[model samples]
Target chain A: MPHREKTRILLVDDVPENLLALEALIRRDDVVVHKAASGDAALELLLAHDFALAILDVQMPGMDGFELAEFMRGTEKTKHIPIVFVTAGGRELNYAFKGYESGAVDFLHKPLDAHTVKSKVNVFVDLYRQSKVLKHQLETLERNRQEQEALLQELTETQEELRKAITIRDEFMSIASHELKTPLTSLKLQIQLRQRYLKKGDASAFTIDKIAKMVESDDRQIQRLIRLIDDMLDISRIRSGRLTVHPATFDLSELVHDVVDRFSEQLAAAGCTVTLTVPGPVVGYWDHFRVEQVVINLLTNAMRYGAGKPVTIVLEAGDGRARLSVRDEGIGIAEEHQARIFQQFERVVSASQIGGLGLGLYIVDQIVRAHGGSIRVESALGKGSTFIVELPVEGNRASDAS
Target chain B: MQANTLLIVEDDPDIRACLEEIMVSEGFEVLTAAHGREALQALQSAQTLPALILLDLTMPVMDGPQFLAELASGRWPEAWQRIPVLVLTAISEPFLAGGVAEVVRKPVDIGVLIDAVARHLPVSLS
Candidate 1:
């Protein structure tokens, strides 16, 4: 154990001579004695330092020992100091009772015995030292308990997060497998149909229109399979931070027009009429193909949710940036789902109603950010939603050039 | 002889067309619906009740379990309740119900599906 500081004792009396004598008799290596010529001076000393014991002379001219003890008892800071009242008065029971009532632990008749005073003072010093040690230990214990509680809470949150990640991964695997199987089944049936036709050994059975229709259906299914695989690949690339963009200058209006034209057939099939509005040739330096993909994803999403409704696409460029907005009149997203829509494998709609891996918006957001752009949604439930994307006109090319 | 009508309830157009063609070639009249809601509507308007129903378990508007509950709840006319239902599903477990005759797993073997249909129909059209 570390060496403790010396215990302090306050020796107060009206006469300086008596204070000196008491200090000389009680002085020891483990104790420090502070002498005061009056009770008021003793209170000043008590205010400045913490003493284990106070030896006071009862018959003093100003602020007598009994009065000082009463004052000390009334004050919060000095009330706990162990007091010993020493006087030359006779050892009457009434006087001793008054001394004890004034907060003195022990009373000594003066012309005091040296050993008796020393022993009584020693007991109080020992108690104060033990209490200080106990308080320090309690503080350390409380701190450690709080730290352990915080650590436990952190561990529980981490475990919950890990469980959620595992669930999403399992769901992704099952959905991907199901999507792949559906196309494979169609392909198998088509092949079986062709084989049966050939087995009949009639070349005339392979008419031009029938062969063309079968080929068209097979191509459509193959495209669906390719789209699913591409989405998976994109997710992996994004997770590994390997998805990169190559910048080239292109007109924003032309790119939007092309993507809209490609989706025209599907939009028409879904009973949706898309109106594209572009002010002029708004040119920008960014990955043309990736930007095209962003527009395509937004348009496809609008068509999926807003089937049989009108969609509007607007492209505007000014103020050192380009903005493209796709508005749809469909069953809009709820407020609670808006924030999570950009996260991987998150979908507000059921997969049975709208078949997708839920990677479309995630990929779109990633590409937009890579081009130094931001995307946001504005909508209310039961009304339609508008997805707005803003990209810097220069498009992070300055860093590449340097 | 009155033709045995088969009802095919499936969401996928390709699968529905394929089954329709196969059943027609087997000499049975076929009617199709995209989901349970559509199937219920068809049943309500039909001139003659189907002898057998080939039901897909998963669909967009309504699913297999919901359809079965509605059918058994006495919502439809009495003549529609006696028709046997054969479930066609990609799911592993069989759907055991009073009206369900059998469960045929997909990708369905054409012969197995046809045989199940023939067994449930009052007259084997083949």
Candidate 2:
């Protein structure tokens, strides 16, 4: 799968005949020979290609072997190329020392020995190939290390997220059990009281009235249990990504009014007064049923948190967008808790104080976003909160309506 | 008459009413409060201290723990201190550390609740 390139050797001499002789002597199956007639020509070849070894003639017309070697040593590109100097001059110690000082690996005497030159060239070529392999392996190792570190970081984050999810789930289960038991206890007591009255044969008007009241109380508790179960099912649907929205053209103001009217009894019980401010009909293509759910959730939240306070709902449509705001004058959310309130199983108030699965706002957020809208809150401690939802009028209508 | 009095402290109106009716039919005088704070207020204004208190653990404004703490803090009248508390809760473990006569878990059997109340009530009152 991986292609291996041939090792290259450069032969440099001013004389063409000497270049041919050197090239012929060093040419092999694994190596490619490049012949350059002068130092300038050799430098040109070196710049264009990578060579395992360079054989240079000490005596040249210009830019001789020592000068070329010194120049190559100064340049980063050619500095590591092993140089072997070949000269027809005397076997003098000073010439050899000068060759070594100029970055030559070996110096050969005149009238060249073919066997010795080949062996020396082979040694330098082998060293160059080994170093290249080592460098490649080092690069591979570094890359593997970096990838491993990234995977480890991802694993750690995923583990932390999983831990938090488990804790929330445990807390939710505990709260759910408690919530279920409270109404169940009341329901059982109501039934037992009715049975006791019936066994006593007490058919008086007073007994009848008390029984009627207990029956009504039982109905309320049963409704609460049903709502809790419904909320749990909604959470499952949301988690499975199966929540569907069926949209149609409708007046947003009318829908808001209708939802508010449905909560009139609860609002009165909480001592909360709601004021609706809608100047005109604001039409939108959205899921009417889902939108009703959102309004109901917001209103219920307002009544629960804004007990004995005034709540206001304002609807305005302009510039291809519809905006609805629900403002409550009650105990407000803290700045840090505003964002967390929209997450599943998260509540700003303690579970003991408030009774719910804490899935209302999360389901509301999901439905609003599915309609190509955004929801946000503005609140301060003890000042109250306003939940604003803005939906696009035209865009995402087709998909939503479908 | 004072010794037969019993107090029911619970937030749920339906449950509180049901308990009160049950206790009244059992020949005991029942006083009710919506929460711990209300219970304390009722105790402060009572002409005769209740012989026993049926306390629910979780409630808004103030809970069972707060009520027990206030009762033991030596601020209430001496007669209120001797009244035994019967804890009613849905939690697995008892939330109260001390000053509780019994722990009754919900959804509690009416028979068991009534029996516990009778056992904890002062013999003079019963």
DockQ of 1: 0.37
Model 2: residues >4 Å from true position, as ranges? A1-3, A36-47, A59-64, A70-75, A87-104, A204-208, A248-262, A276-288, A315-323, A390-396, A400-402, B4-7, B47-50, B63-83, B93-101, B122-126
Fraction of true inter-chain Cα contacts (below 8 Å) kept per model? 0.16, 0.54
Candidate 1: regions farther than 4 A off: A1-7, A28-37, A44-48, A74-79, A90-104, A200-205, A398-402, B14-28, B56-58, B63-65, B88-126
Clashes of each: 0, 0
Q: Which structure among the candidates has the greatest TM-score?
A: 2
Taking the tens digit of each residue's C-alpha lDDT, what string does model 2 give over A86-142?
877766743543436544378777678999988898899888888888888888999
lDDT of each: 0.81, 0.85
> How good is model 2 by TM-score?
0.84
lDDT of 1 by residue, A1-402 (tens): 213766789999988888887887888888889999898899899999888888888888878888888788778898888888887887673254344665546777778789987788777877878877777788889889999989999999999999998998887876677667666666766776666558777576479997886776678678778878988998899999988898899899998988787667667766799989999999999998788879988998998778779999999988999999999999899999998999988888776556567899999999999988999999888799999999999998866676
The number of the candidate with the highest lDDT is: 2
Clashing pairs in 2: none
| Model 2: how far residue A164 lies from native, Å | 2.6
What DockQ does every candidate get?
0.37, 0.58
